[model samples]
Target chain A: MGILDTSPRVRAAALVAPPFLYALALLAFPLIAIIVISFWTQSGLALNRVFTLENYREIFSSPIYVWGNANRWGVLPLSLFVSATVTLVTVVLAYPIAYFVSFVVAPERKALWLFLITIPFWTSYLIRVFLWKVILGFNGVVNTGLQSLGVIEEPLSVLLYNLNSVIITLSHAYAVFAILPIYVALEKIDRSLLEASQDLGESRFSTFLRVTLPLSVPGIVGAVLIVFIPTIGDYVTPELMLGSGGRLMSNVIQTQFLQLNNWPLGAALSIITMLAVGIVSLVFILLNRRWLRGRA
Target chain B: MTYSPSAAPLIQLRDVHKHYGDYHALRGIDLEIKKGEFFSLLGPSGCGKTTLLRTIAGFEAPSSGSLTIDGRDMAGVAANHRPTNMVFQSYAIFPHLSVAENVGFGLRRDPRSKAEKARAVAESLEMVGLGGYGARAAHALSGGQRQRVALARALILKPKVLLLDEPLSALDKKMRETMQVELIKLQRNVGITFILVTHDQEEALIMSDRIAVMFEGNIAQMADPETMYRRPNSRRVAEFIGKMNLLPATAAMERNRIVVDVAGLGRGAIEPDQAPSGVQPGATTVGIRPETLSILFPGETTDRRLAAGTVDEVVYFGDMTYYDVRIPGVEQPLTISMKNLIGRPVLDVGAVTQVVWDERSLVVLSR
Candidate 1:
């Protein structure tokens, strides 16, 4: 009679219907549409009613497609490696800053440091990448100044339009992305735990390793996922800093969708990219859970 | 029981002064703690009892003066390097570690192989009565078990002294009492000097061999628990340590005896042979513990001692009965507590009764 006494079937249906409808309208329908279009012939009459693997086979067999696939796979590992290296470097640099902010700086001045770290993010992302370009270009300020100061005889050719340039530019642009989560984790740790660690006969370095580092794994995981996942699919930084040789999967997807005028292949490529990212992220989540469980 | 006293005190704090900016946190404090003694620093919040414990643990360096443990100066020594460990009020168990891991944290740094570490961990766990709980996460343990883990962790290091910062305040009443007895047994078994900081007077009185009563960042008195309860040195200590009835009195010398006149009661002088030293002839306060006062029936006046009063209020605790007696001309009512031996309550409200106490039970306090 009352809402609390509602039947189980009705209650379950009531709880699930709205979200299911929203997902169908927003996500599942679009995905089904893409998959349906990926199998269509040139006439667009859905004549290939039988589900066929031709679209995938054609993309995998062609040389250009193969090269694109190779480039995509190549960028996947390279981007992940670059992101990991940048995360490690950022953590090494940000840890002391975070420690200083948490322990040395007065509470009143902490907001100032946070604001300074966040000020760069307020600027346009593209403009920041462009500024890095101006600074790292052949005739840019860094090369001219180094040449004038007699630090170098010629402008450095490796500073731009390559894998290193993309990595450097992306690292600089997303440095705060790594710092904020780690800072939040450090802030949430109890101060009494530190004192207890000291009172329990642990040296400062040992305490940091045993207590502080293990506790910050969640934040470190977040930082890695935030930087690595996005960087794998990024086209802007690589396109602006590196030319065709450094182009990633996102760039190829863009070309297939717009320049090649092949919607079905583009859809297939998009699905493949999604699958790769999903698999990598799933693996990372599983590993992180295991590590946390072991620690716990 | 054939324990030998150490040649020097296990812990000695000499002329210790600590200041936080302009606020003086600890005055010049000198204390000597013998080996295997259970000492307590008892005070209200902000009374600097915790600061003294922290200073002993080497967490907070004293602003001035010297601290020595076992004849070694503690200057510039960090907490990890000191010969003392503390059980924090919060217990401070590592939520990520298991119960055994929490207990063995201090011993992990020992120069031992993995098997040895595991053995030590098992031993400590067994010592804390949690033998088979090595794999239980700390968060899964109850509060009492967590407290035991903290104790085992501190004791595993074999420190010269163990400091507890209100460690039992987090437990419920029944658990606290159980832990108190267990702690006493553990201390006796371990034979280490244990210093506890607490604001609970009953806890200090029950567990400590000696209690140092602190007030306003200074120690008011220090003595054995019985002496501290019976003869507190100052009015502040008398009020802080236990319940006392303070009555206004004027003192005068008569026949070499110290005479005192309570406001409502007639004048009486302490016998010259039994008078305290420095009993000046002037106005003073007389203090008597509530339990020392006895109620007598009407027409039961004694020769020189009994005082008659009307019972204003009676509180019936399960174990004891408390009465607030208002005598004529006395501005404040006198409190008296009697053990509830009989099945019936002692007196009804508004009943007239004579209150009597031994002359020696009265403590005359100077301003």
Candidate 2:
């Protein structure tokens, strides 16, 4: 009775309080901890607990922290390049499959096709990454098949333990994330719009370009963010296929925390990566504002 | 405007049939729409009116028949290549585009300058009464505005034939009526052949120069609106186009006339044209429109034949009131409509009355 007799505003706050506190405890507190630690100094076996900008200074001035060097690119820029490439490849490959499921498949069979798309997710992600290693390894199926067909004299050495392999693995791993949003977008399109496009003097391909593509921009934006954001911080693919060549920003952050015992530096780099992702995502959204916000 | 019967047909369909797997959608449709004619395919849902329109628009290819537009055979022609454009029932305005961009979309390949295209878009929007709305986002439009945009977009292409698939069905009744008048005016202004598909019979009757009443994938009857309404070829067509009261009767053909013994209303001699679906000498049903039968309100005099009846029910409309009168020997109560004019008192149930009906208004349908 006491709770029920409360004012409507108080009742509303009471209803919202549990999830808000849970989020503050699990999510916001850890983020706040990271922010506080990022400003601190770490000494051997102990945190100095004094606010300092030395970590940020090192990140900006250090040669190793540069995006690239004369011989090879640094981990930060390489990670950015790899994730961007992965995002592009996954989105491009996902679109036609999404289109097929949404438009070509019969209405009754659509659920089945969408369910089949999720079959890749049933296996453990690490197992999926390992499967990619097997597929793209030196003696893997592609190289062996080419060798068996006398198309190659030896297995290709460029297939694994590199950024290219990392990109390939991550692209395959996050393909479901790209496909789902795009499929939903394509599915939401009114079928009559295509006919209207054709009736308006557009050929089938031209209709796709003019009507279908423009209408699905929301889905494309969603798919781009879904595949792009978390992939920049992905740790599994680069670690599985390892070397200096395959190491990424996440790997460097892991080393600072585990090997160098410099939690503050690691936290600072983590914050920097988050900032980069936020900036990139914000810029991407701004670029697509005409498609996303204008019509909506 | 002025439609000449001798003018070559702008659109023609010969025995058009559409089969979606096993379900036959359009069956043996033969039609010709003349240039500058407002033609309608009127039917209930699933009667294949939309399918026939789609076939004409080149969205659906007929299974075993030929379609021609502007004297050219449409076989193997894609929708984009056809001289036709469609205003979809859903309006289908591209949500990502502005009103002007949507209207100008079909003009992409035109050799005109960009300024010319823009002018054409503005003109098209103005024609649809959305003149200054070109800058508005398409998605932000109301239902009626979206309809105008769709009409503008389709009309801007200036195709030889414009197909409207139940274009006004999405609007409210008043808005639909308003758009109907606007569409008729626009069609006259453009001089393009319009083939509309609709289930609303009143809309069809109001808009079409001629209407083909379809039922179960068949064109039951096709004629001018007045003929289709007054002399329906079958009881199905009669019941579909409007509220028709059918009385069981036996018709015998005399030379150039049908002598019908209509139950409850007694014997009448109708012209040969009144028996639209030719009458056999045996059993049949005669269709009477409610408006043609009026209750002889007190002091009303008419030379038409009268039948004694009791008012079983009364429904009051603002302008007209309908009475369901129970007549002797009639299977169902015969309905009579009366105008609520000055000095005419509204009749109540159980009031004794005489109903006036004309033999000229009777349509004899086969039993």
Candidate 3:
């Protein structure tokens, strides 16, 4: 008998087995290991392997400082704030570019416009982040250019080595993530809906607000989660740009595992960060569902 | 309702032209549509029928000439500012909105109270026979339901003109027929002028009081359904609107009457009105609809002109039977339609028969 004559259950198993097994091995296994380790106790140069609430107790009770900021409360909220700001900035900036590519570019030239938008990705992301470092440095591109143009009397020290520099770098680094999803959403919109809005007596701007924006909610949500989740745990931008001043949760987790030799503590921190990201993403998905009410 | 000659034209276009870069979409269109008239723009695709409708809706400005509605020139007005609404071909219902929200979309800028606008929305939905479907999601509705929602949304605005861009083309045959009757009834009840763009000639004939037949960016003919079907101005239009058997003929003007010698049906005198575009003495064509010609049974008799022919092909369509009758003189077989009744028979191919025709049914077209 041919493959088409097989039972639906057998066909479904054949179709789904590969990816399901791959995800189980690569994703679920590591997460399960981390969750188990989060509950174990860490001794000097050894792991007790005994279940204990000591790590959780210390995590909730202690107010230890990391680079002059509290590790538990201060650094976590700072990471969230920085990631939220970057997400807002990246999405807000990416929306107009996506809209231009989808609506303004001619049908034949749209591929060229999207290619140009993604040109930054041709280079390594780390290299792009280092380039932002060069651009935002005190004696770098922005300050020097402004001084040469007589717009500034001196180099501005406030341009780099702060939370702003980390935000600027991460926003630039994750720009393509925000832009691609938003562009796909905008492109999927039926152009007739815009004309219908105008026919219903709405201005072009109002039509964009009422029809185009709401229809692209899925893309916006996709972009938000894509940028927000990864940037919240980003260690590179904070370490490279902010120096020791504004280190994030990722830097602390790395310190525990590599420098402090606390595998159990690092695994616990990783679990907590994962849960935090999950909750925030869940909140965002819920908001997206609310925005997409009554839609197919 | 049909247009009245005495009333002032509600919308007038004086030599309107639209050019999209190198393509000439509309070429010097001059039109007048009266208020409360159910008018249609009918053509095959790329015939500039939709372009003319878009021009009236203020979506595309004419490259030249002036368009006016209610005596005001529509020069700089945008689509949103124009007193016109459209039901898009795809229905274009806002997928994110409920039925009520979509119907009330145009009322965003209205000065009325919120309750009054809500009531207007409800009433508009009721008019389109979607009264209790307000809370339903627009994207969840079927094709016919979405069409009704689109109609309700546009009609809620109560604009001077309602533009429909092939609104019924997406529905199934039965649903399209149902909507056609509903649209006619709605237009009558609302008293708003509806300008429908359609490629389906039958739908235009059934729905429109007057139809403008377009071909290659030009208006070929504009008349009521009966006049359009009976006295099409050109051979192309006659072929486009319905099935017309164009027989080769020669015509000569004798005083006021035109004499045409059809290849198969012989010579006959025709009135001036039989040749809508005016007949010149030369080789021409004469068109006659299939139903206008009949086949005589053995026991039947008629006062009409008769010719001896053999049935070449037969197609039975339940209630009617079409036969291709080949006469001795005509090169192409002429199709004749006959209704199947209690006593009539479906003729078989190769059967010898007498085809009945009339001189009054001849429409002469210049070659």
Please state the Cα-based DockQ of model 2 relative to the true two-chain complex. 0.81
Candidate 1 local Cα displacement, residue B296, angstroms: 1.9
What is the per-residue lDDT of model 3 for residues B46-144, given as tens digits with 9 covering 90 to 100?
999999999999989999999999999999999998889999999999888999999999999899999999899999889888889989888899999
lDDT of 1 by residue, B18-124 (tens): 99999899999899988888889999999999999999998899999999999899999999999998899989888878888888888766998989888888887
Interface RMSD of 3: 1.0
Residue by residue across A133-185, what tens digits does model 3's lDDT show?
Answer: 88989889999999999999989988899888988899888998999999999
What are the runs in model 1 whose C-alpha is more than 4 Å off? A1-29, A39-51, A58-73, A90-92, A294-296, B1-7, B268-278, B297-304, B343-346
Best by DockQ: 3
TM-score of model 1 vs. true structure: 0.90
Off by over 4 Å in 2: A1-18, A244-246, B253-257
Q: Identify the superior model by TM-score, candidate 2 or candidate 3.
A: 2
Report model 2's TM-score to 2 decimal places: 0.96
Q: Tell me the TM-score of each prediction against the true structure.
A: 0.90, 0.96, 0.95
Worst lDDT run of 10 residues, candidate 1 chain B, spans B1-10
iRMSD of prediction 1: 1.8
The fraction of reference interface contacts (C-alpha pairs within 8 A across chains A and B) present in each candidate is 0.62, 0.88, 0.94
